[model samples]
Target: MFKNIAKDEMNLQDKPMSRFVNFNEWIFEIKTIRAIRVSDYGQPYSAMANINIHGESAFVDSLMTKSEQEFARIDAKVISEFLRQLGIEQVQFERFKNNQPRLHSVSLASEPHKEHKAKLVSVG
Candidate 1:
């Protein structure tokens, strides 16, 4: 929620490297959840409880633990909301030739979610 907004604001600041690193950590945490679910399912369920930080000197590692399908769904929703807040009207995802998901388009304007004649753009 506001955490992503704060991260976005940080990205707009002068120290963008650190902010970008943080943002990438967030993305990795999110995408990893999906990958883990897609990998296995018959393991013990776990969750991301409150991250308790002791002080500024505390060791903070960006490690993604095993997550359940429900956690992955929540992360997906959070990412979608964050993208919406960033003025992205639509995000088109397509499967590659190997059936892997990839980001196809990020449209600022809303487009019909269907196969249209004008949508065909030669990549070559």
Candidate 2:
């Protein structure tokens, strides 16, 4: 049932996909499944929603350095909302044997944040 639902939601094509560069601490390659067309030029552009953060150490350090619980709560809320806007239902943090942080698979769902309507954008 879930497989059918997922298949219905996504459109697969054999054509080559466009890649976008995210220049930050780390390099990210974002690919979009749909093509966006401009009304003025009628040119079609693919969307790539990739983001690159410098590294996990920087993120962990920021979280650890927060002195107040309120600050930490605010930070977590921001991150959660950001992820929710990206169609992520839940986020889990994991660490490897070397203590390197990694993100696990994200389960896609409808937007959970109700306060911000401006952040919602149609990707498909």
Candidate 1's TM-score reads 0.23
lDDT agreement of model 1 with the native = 0.30
List pairs with backbone clashes in candidate 2. Answer: 25-54
**Candidate 1 clashing pairs, residues 3+ apart or interchain:** none
Q: What TM-score, over all chains together, does every model reach?
A: 0.23, 0.27
Q: Enumerate clash totals for all models, in the order shown.
A: 0, 1
lDDT of each: 0.30, 0.32
Question: In model 1, how many backbone clashes occur?
Answer: 0
lDDT of 2 by residue, 1-124 (tens): 0222221233333232223333554444332222122234555422212233221111212223222222233333334334444334544433333577655433334432332221222232
lDDT of 1 at 119: 18
Best by TM-score: 2
Per-residue alpha-carbon lDDT of candidate 1 for residues 1-124, written as tens digits (9 for 90 to 100): 1223344432332221110123322421111212222224776534332221221111112214454233433443333333343333454433233555443444523532222221111221
